[model samples]
Target chain A: MSEEIIIAGFGGQGVLSMGKILAYSGIMQDQEVSWMPSYGPEMRGGTANVTVILSDERISSPYLKVYDTAIILNQQSMDKFENTVKPDGILLYDPNGITHHPTRKDIKIYQIEGAKLAAEMDNKKIFNMIVLGAFLKIKPIVKLENVIKGLKKSLSERYHHLIPLNKEAIDTGMKHLKKFNIEKHIIHN
Target chain B: MAELKLMKGNEALAEAAIRAGVDAYFGYPITPQSEVIEYLMAERPEKRTGMVVLQAESEVAAINMVYGAASTGKKVMTSSSSPGISLKQEGISYMAGAELPAVIVNVVRGGPGLGTIQPSQADYFQSVKGGGHGDYKLYVLAPASVQEMSDFVADAFDIAFKYRTPVLILSDGLIGQMMEKVVLRDQVERITDEDLIKTHGSWATTGKTNRNRNIVTSLDLQSEKMEARVHRLQKKYKQMELEDLRYEKIDCDDAEYLIVAYGSSARISQKAVEIARKKGIKVGLLRPLTLFPFPKKQLFELADQVKGILSVELNSGQMVEDVQLSVEHKVPVEHFGRTGGIIHTPEEVLDALEQKIITHGHFRNHKTRESSIL
Candidate 1:
């Protein structure tokens, strides 16, 4: 199976790291994976994005204009990538600071209030892990054990103590994701 | 045993250089490629293999350091982006003149001047056409993947020492920054001083030990001597073209149209080929591994099989000239590019192929988007 995904949000939201962890999970399963981040000025406290591809066969490109899934974390990203998802593809987002919801009828849409959940959990940093967990719940492309291993690999040794908390956040994310009916979407000219 | 790990192209290349018995790396850090030096500095290859990693004051100083280290027959290398590479041109020319064996990496960024720190293939002409002024050619390797980025370190060093000329690993910021799974090779021990003296004693500047000094310089005052030196350099280049040319062909057996690309562009074009074939369009990709030896002969042969050829690059259109020259206009050759760090998508490449090659801009229904672009 080949899954091309784009994870996008404001720079500090761990958008890039979520993609990295996903890519690492793919590697743990011996699948070919590529993680390409947008490393321009936009990454500095502005909108940041990374294109992650997990494939059974050799991956052809790391940079893609369209994706099988778009994991959006902010209004800017939701506004931009909602249309880039392939028809019948998945659009997962966190409705924390988002104003405009996804408006595509051809693609499946889901929401996880990552920021609010992280605040309730009293650990703001696990917001991305929560979003990642939500994504895995829908796709299950990678096993949980592998995702844990990937999280360990992505984080430094000093932060290993936080894995359990991250794991909890991930579980919460999986439990809390809500899907949109996606009926009668308004078309923008 | 080969160990597999996910790594950025620049990091993988640096790790591979350490494993491949590199003696020293002298470089100045630049965006997109700074990780090469950063990884090397952090790994402390000196502790592991007695290799030296130094950050020079400037790009010029770094390249000169490479020239100095290589003159002593050491496995040496340096890396930089477009502007920094431009600053090192003089030193690169000096290395070429002295016939030094060293590996240089250009993780290219957009530029005529300090343009942008974004990935670009604009350096294609600068790399293959002798960026440094002189009668010399660097055996250029254009790596398309992180695996190749790791693997080509040893390959470039091999070509550098085998031919007694400098070799360049021509990469771009995209490949440099992208991370992927790469199988790391087992570490090879560095060449001992005794082995170094014995192997390169004939031409190296290892000091006058019980004999005449082995002088290393590119200077020959006599006109005929200079002519001979240039001819010898040319002969080496010819040998490289004959012996070590590298390329890859995908889905070309039944392809009606071909896309010629290298490095990261090849990866994108490969996807485009897959999409085109899925749509029942007979398309293929030709990826040139060695830019200097260039798959001209192979491209010429493919011209006979394919009805059209599209040269895809991240530049305004440098390699397109070479593509045209390769096929001698046997088939229609056109260029599609996205400069200033913009990468074209797979669909965009296919659309360009359709508009520019398949139809050849003849009998099209509308203005062809060229007017809109203009």
Candidate 2:
């Protein structure tokens, strides 16, 4: 199946890194993947987004329409990508950032207190990991072991201590997001 | 051989040039390509790699330095972006006219002016067709990967020295920024001080003990001599076409639609081709590794096989014209791109390809759509 996703937020929110991790994992799994970012002034601030597509076959273009999934880290990102989500797509959003609920009833929207969960684990920066955990639970593209391996590779040498906390945050997010999987009736017509 | 390190394409090019025994680097910093200069500067290759690095005041001065160094028969090089490359074109032409061997890299960016610092293949015509006054060609290498950037540096220098011409590494920001592992060369052959070309001995100066030596200027007072010079350069270019047109074809043997792209845009097109393949579409990619000595023959052969050709680039229909010229109207040539700072995604390319099939039967009008910022 063609799984096209866009992870968007401001700079330093780990949006690009999250997308990179996903694309890199897909590559490791022998899945065809493409990752295109808003590699412009948006990288400096305003807004940042990366579109990732992982398919069983080669990816045609890095551009997207009716993206199968989206992870919005901030309210601005949610507003930007909300309209583009496919009817059967899953949107994992940061509850702290997105105050307003998604208007679309066709798509499944999961709200998680990512920052709070990560902060409880003593590293707020792992909010992306928390959201990533939610993504792993929903998408099931790469196994958790591969994601952890990719995460370890992505971490800086100095920040090596944070991996355990990040993993904990992922587990927390996975546990929380697992409740949504039961409703097979929620599938789009 | 060790495992490949995830290094940016521009950095890899710098390391490759050093390993290739490039004697000196004279360049100005421009985004996408600035990392190359930074890599050289940080490494301070003088003691280790035996090369001199200089950050020039302007691209004009940098190209002039390259011209000076190359005349000495040294493997000198320089790099810049589109606007900066435009400034260096005059010197590039001069190097070509003097038959000096050197390498110039143009890490292309969107522009007519100071366009935003991003990946662009708009300089295809600028690099292939002479950007400066006078008829000349710089053996241009368009690398699609950081690995190829390393692979092509030595080849670029070899071609330059072989033809007594300037060679260009025509890259874009995507390749410049993206990291990939590269297998580096072990031995580096550096030019010694003994090998320095003392232009003081040659007629590089007018009054230097010459008993009235004829000027070796591209400007020939006699029309016949000028024609001969042009013919000579043309012959060299012809030889290059026979020997140096490097390209990669993937799944193109039975492609219904062929996507012609190069450099970073070609990498994105590779992703797009994969997606199209999964959909049961017989799509293929023709990635040009050498921009100049344009791969006309391979493109023509593909035109004979494919239903139609789609030229994907990061510019406003620049390479499309070249593809048209190559195919010679044997088949319809369409283009898809996003200019300025925007990068065309694989999905957009797929849409264009699908549109090409669904809309017009075969003969398609050239549609140049302005890319919107997302």
Candidate 3:
């Protein structure tokens, strides 16, 4: 099964890095993966996003207007991408930033206090890790251990000390995940 | 032998450039194509093979520097997106006029002017019909995937050096953005100054030489000589029609209808062909991977058996003209597509085929519509 995902947030919020981590995890798992960023000017300020496509077979195109999953870090990102989520897709958002809720009942919505959880872990920047953990809980496309390995491999020696805090943030976010899955057609057995 | 690795389009191009024995790379950073420069900058193959990579001030300077490097009989190339490719047209025309061998890659973006950073095939006419002044042709190759993107760079250089002309890789945003598994080629033999028709000498502004002053200038005021020069170019182009034409034909032998498309558009067209066959429509796809030589002969041969032709593209009927030219008055060549950064889906092409059947019967006086286009 192929899973196409979009991760969007403000610049330096690690939205791009989050997508990269997911893609790297897919590659490590031996799945065909592609990561494409917003073409040009869309990368500047308002919102920065990346599309990660993980598939068992060859992927024809990287451009997507409708994605199977979207992880939004801010209200603005949720506002921009909410309409584009495919039917029965998952919408994971940071409850600390987005006050408004999803209007679509068809989409499985997971709202986590990502910023607050990261602050409790003594690192607010680990908010991205919170979102990643939520994705792992909802999709379970890759193993949690694989993601941890990917993160450790990607982190530089200079910042190796932050790995434990980041790991705690992921665990906290996963613990708070409230699955709103309404689709019984999914064959998880 | 190298294993297939999932690589981005630009990264593939960089690996291909090295395998193609590229001696120099001159380019400026642009969207969709920036990864190419980044890859080359990081790889630093120049230290091992005497290669040189320079980030130029602009696309114009880059192409001119390429022109200079090519004149030295070195394998040189530059890559850019639509806007930058437009700026390099002047230098490209000069390189072509002087019969210099150089490879230029344009990772196309939407535009008549600063259109957008998105993927586009709007530059079809510009790349094939000559974007610069005067009459000229760039040997244009369109690859649909990252694997092809990696494979075509070496082929582009080989064709350029063999034909003594500028070769263009007319890649779109899809090819630039996508990632695929590509088997990287090992180190290959390099071409030196002595391998070319003419190298740096008194004519190339190279310090000194003993032979008659070779003139590399494109300005030939003498009409007869200029005419003769053009004829020679025409003859070479004609010869290329014999050796350089390339296309991928799938299930065309017994098919009654043919779809003509290229680049990423053709990839979807391939799936459409499969869909049509399952429905018993007897449809096949003729993908002209090389846009300039166009594989006109294949279209002409299929025209005799096929009922009609459908030309698909990312623009409004640009490549349709080429199919029409090939089919002549033998069959109808209908156009289908959406332009301006929008990609036409496979379902849309299937709809176009059904529409073709609805409007015109098997042949439906195909002669008349054919004449209007050809």
Clashes (backbone N, CA, C under 3 Å), per candidate, total 0, 16, 0
Winning model by DockQ: 1
List-wise, what DockQ does each model earn? 0.78, 0.26, 0.28
Candidate 3 displacement at residue B198 in angstroms = 12
**Model 3 clash pairs?**
none
Report the C-alpha lDDT of model 1 over A52-102, residue by residue, as the tens digit.
999999999788888999999888888888889999999998877877777
Chain A (alone) TM-scores for all candidate structures: 0.94, 0.87, 0.87
**B1-374, model 3: which lDDT tens digit per residue?**
77556577888998888776788999999987999999999988786566789999999899999998887677899999999999999999898888888999999888878887787888999988978987788889999888889989989987887778999999988778766556788777675444443433233434345556556667789999888878877787887788998888878989888888888788767767766888888988888878988888788899999888898888877888988888876877788877777777676787887787435745555557665678
Q: Model 3: what is its DockQ?
A: 0.28
lDDT of 2 by residue, A1-189 (tens): 778898988898888888877766665666666666676677887788887777887444455556888888888887889988988788877767667556676887776667887778787677788888888888788877777776666666797787777778778888766322224423221
The residue-level lDDT of candidate 1 at B29 comes to 89
Clash pairs of candidate 1? none
Identify the CAPRI category of the predicted complex in candidate 1.
medium
Task: Find the 10 residues in a row with the least total lDDT in model 2 chain B.
Answer: B365-374
Model 3, A31-144: lDDT tens digits are 877776765666677688887888897764455667899998888887899987889888887756667666777887776677777777777788898888878878899887
Model 2 segments more than 4 A misplaced = A1-5, A19-35, A52-69, A83-89, A103-108, A137-189, B180-226, B275-281, B354-358, B362-374
**Fnat of every candidate, listed in order:** 0.82, 0.33, 0.31
* Comparing 2 and 3 on lDDT, the stronger one: 3
lDDT of each: 0.91, 0.78, 0.80
Cα error of candidate 2 at position A150, Å: 4.8
